[model samples]
Target: MTKTRIMIALVVLLAGLKSNGQEALFGGQEIVSPEINKDKSVTFRLLAPAADSVFITGDFLPTTKMKTPMGEMDAPGKKLLSKNGEGLWTYTTEPLASELYNYSFIVDGMTVRDPNNPFVIRDVSSLTNIFIIGGGKADNYKVNDVPHGTVAKRWYDSPGLGMDRRITIYTPPGYEDSKEEYPVLYLLHGAGGDEEAWMDLGRTSQIIDNLIAEGKAQPMIIAMPNGNVTQDAAPGMGSDGFYKPVFMAPKTMDGTYEANFMDIIKFVENNYRVKANKENRAIAGLSMGGFHSFHISRYYPNTFDYVGLFSAAIMPREDATGEVYNNINETLEQQYKNGLELYYIAIGKTDFLYKANQDLKKQLDEIGMPYEYVETDGGHIWRNWRIYLTDFAPKLFK
Candidate 1:
């Protein structure tokens, strides 16, 4: 063909491809799924013309009671989305409070994530779309125009577990540039979570960054270690490759993880520029991780001057047997004797472990052990956990 003919053909082909790409992406007109309004009421839109019905369910909605094997509990309520003439389904929530919320779409009985919303978080086995309502407590969770910290996933040798493990570390702003040695906080995750949990689900980095910038908290290093003893890291992130995650895993609450806790501290102290003493060391966790913190701090009596437990699972398994699990009272007695700056415990009012935490408080009272207790409204949820962290961090290393 001639040169002009070839140029004309190329132009035609490129134009066709561009048209098809736009059609595939937006289906003719652009669709913005989540549009945060000025009134704080969120409008969710989905382009599902062929679907018979559509509904939206999320943590922002009011909860209802649902029966499960454990017992009757509260679950996020579902709201029906009205279909538009163009097949665009939409629903607008009432003015929501400032907090982070996750939701999913139920289209024709199949549950799926919001295709237009790229922000999502994974909790164990499930993934859902997430959004933050600014102007309140959730503002701390959002990434703002502040001096940010560095988040890194580093691997370290764990001889006790007989495998290399991965941990997420957050070094505050100016850490690399400064020669200062900072205090260390060993943060842990619950069952079915890995090093990625606190960073993603709990918004640890963002919260800490905001708190530091606002002068509410001090600059420090946060080391988030995987609590699961059998796995080296999160699924698809470990040496075992990808696998399905479950709510419960073997050796989760066993004494093995607590006994080997020093390995993590050793790795952090050796690798990072941190203050290597009990007074500069702190530990905290949520759910299963809280249980681990409760046991590990006591096991290592004089290691940590600050400890926090949020919605902790207080009791171990019936068959759990080990020296770490045994002599809990004696260990706690020693921990108190060593002198702690802060022994903080926070939980939801309706949490499943409420009674257990009460029992623990009673035991501490009988021993005349001092601790700061906080009770908020909710169950075993991330909302309460984030609040607890926000409250507890301000009181650290002071």
Candidate 2:
């Protein structure tokens, strides 16, 4: 063939390629990675040219049954993926409830973030992509136009813990200027969490701000302290780093937390302009934190008038021995006599700790302790905790 004819044919082919919208490699048309449908269903897509299998995991999907510190349990949701001829993998979820969910992609057995989704959150260990299904309960998870609070990472001297520890503080709107002393909530984190837990995964600021704006909650200071008794901070940055394994910290924490408990209270009381009164002080935690809140409030019965326990790690059959129960019941009786305002206990009906909470309630009933019990829908996940906080905070200092 002549050179001129070949060149003309190549030009025609190039023009056809450009006009046909045929991409060079694998991408051509606009691909929306995660498209939230009007019906609240979510469609996720990923482009992988060389992948054998792809799977997606999130709270929106049920995970395999696995053993936890509480006991052996199975998760709630699960999802699989399908591939198309264009090397694009896709999966669509059924209509999920209105809530905040974190998800990740597993491409050929290698876990990865959603390359197409830019919104991601860093939990204790790894980064997970996140999406919000906006509606009823989920609305609290978002940042609204209402006045927001400030979350500060501050370090304080914990002579009780024998080291300087870090804590996250959230001062509500108008706190800096308001000469009025505000009520304080001593919020604590669960196991494997840090001072950043409530502020990060729990959506502390967003919830508090939105509630305060809507008049659902009074403006109060929330002090979230790390609850790892053995460790100083989170997994890292502590005297006991991640290298040091802490299993069932609730069972193993002899008296370090109790011994150092007053130190944290002192730190918060002295640093913040909180009203130093029993009615103005509240203590609450989830899971291991719930365990801590249960004990700490009892240890100093008259200290905190308001107590909240979300999925508390209460072991009545084991931890609540005869002697312990006798002492705790005595304190419980004293707190009741001293006019305890609110003794709130909350846990998901399906939580692994559900049986434990029930046992604790039985003991409470036997001791004639009057407390409020809230049973939610889901298990021991953050959804319940966040909702518990949203519900519990409004009832504070009222």
Candidate 3:
């Protein structure tokens, strides 16, 4: 098991596997599934000969009558994939709008990915193959010839949580050459999400780069941190391979996440060259992360001027306090009176948490809280979250 012996053994094993054709295993098959065509339409193919049936699932399809948000849309309720003589099942989608989409193959009722496509992203919420439809608003997600930003997987010590945790940071294109301080955006992930959630599925870096390049958004640093309270770090960095002290899961009944959040702020301010003030700070989150934003901005009204919530999981008026945000409508009024810049809330009309958002809106309106509300077509999926980021990032520090 010495280092050299292990390497040689691995090389020998890999060579033996490739010796049959010598190149097939290394280069992959000649077929490419989930091919994005120049016309914006996409072709998906799977070589699942043993599968009795196959179906394709992704954001490209409408979200109607789709049992679960992750379920592939098949009108008349299901899309029966077509089988070919080569034991390949195929499905081609109509021209799709430009955006990042998640998809997967359903083979005989089991979920699988396109063997031919290597680009895949996963989180607690969903796992699927991702493809980009180039055009329109999606241009922000596409990789253009713009000056790109740098993304770092950074770790900071949290005394409050008594552990080391990770956060993904994105510095805009000119950050390295310039010593000027930049604004900070504390982007949080939802339940079952780690620091990598936004970095992976949300396409945070690409969107920020495109926005800054187009002069739509300021050159700012985005810090995406793990929002789980009970878990000191994300899955791979944790002692249990996931959040533990099982009761500490942020989503669990115990309420402790918001209490320890200052460690994150302090970590950023101390380590990064950021303008640590309300005018130069923004905070946003999706789902559970949204709930965090609503409270964090409310509790510490002077902290972030810009707040965004995408498909937020807000509590009803009654349960909004005690375990959650400090139960005080007066605090909310104070938040508005304290020079809050942008209190933006966005949700899909079809989202399961739509009613919660409605209640939050009602509370905000009753309190005369000046905030912006955006409603898109889909549910609590990454597409809407990405759209929220695309729009919200540009509106910051203006």
Question: What is the lDDT of every predicted structure here?
Answer: 0.90, 0.81, 0.79
Candidate 3: stretches off by over 4 Å: 1-28, 64-78, 242-254, 316-324
Worst 10 contiguous positions by lDDT, candidate 2: 316-325
Q: Report how far off residue 352 is in candidate 1 (Å).
A: 1.2
* Number of the predicted model whose TM-score against the real structure is largest: 1
Per model, how many backbone clashes are there?
0, 5, 0
Task: Give me the runs in candidate 2 sitting further than 4 Å from their true place.
Answer: 1-31, 62-64, 122-126, 236-252, 316-326
lDDT of 3 by residue, 1-398 (tens): 79999999998978776553224465435567778888888888777677889987776765555453323322222356799986778888888877877788888898887777888897673457887777687778877999999999888888877788778889999889988899999998877787888988888998999999889999999998888755656665766674332212534322456767788889888887899898999999998788788787877767888999998878644334444455658778887888888989999877888888999889888988888999998777788899999999989998
For model 1, residues 1-398, the per-residue Cα lDDT tens digits are: 99999999999877776665325634433567788999999999988889999999999888887774334556888999999897889999999999999999999999999888888999988999999999999999999999999999999999999999999999999999999999999998987788999999999999999999999999999999988889898899988888898777788777899999999999999999999999999999998899999999999999999999998888757746877888888989999999999999998987878888999999899878999999999887899999999999888998
Whichever of 2 and 3 has more lDDT, that candidate is: 2
lDDT over C-alpha atoms for residue 265 of model 1: 95
Return the lDDT, model 1, position 193. Answer: 84
Q: Which candidate is the best by lDDT?
A: 1
The C-alpha stretches of model 1 lying farther than 4 A from their native spots are: 1-23, 26-29, 66-73
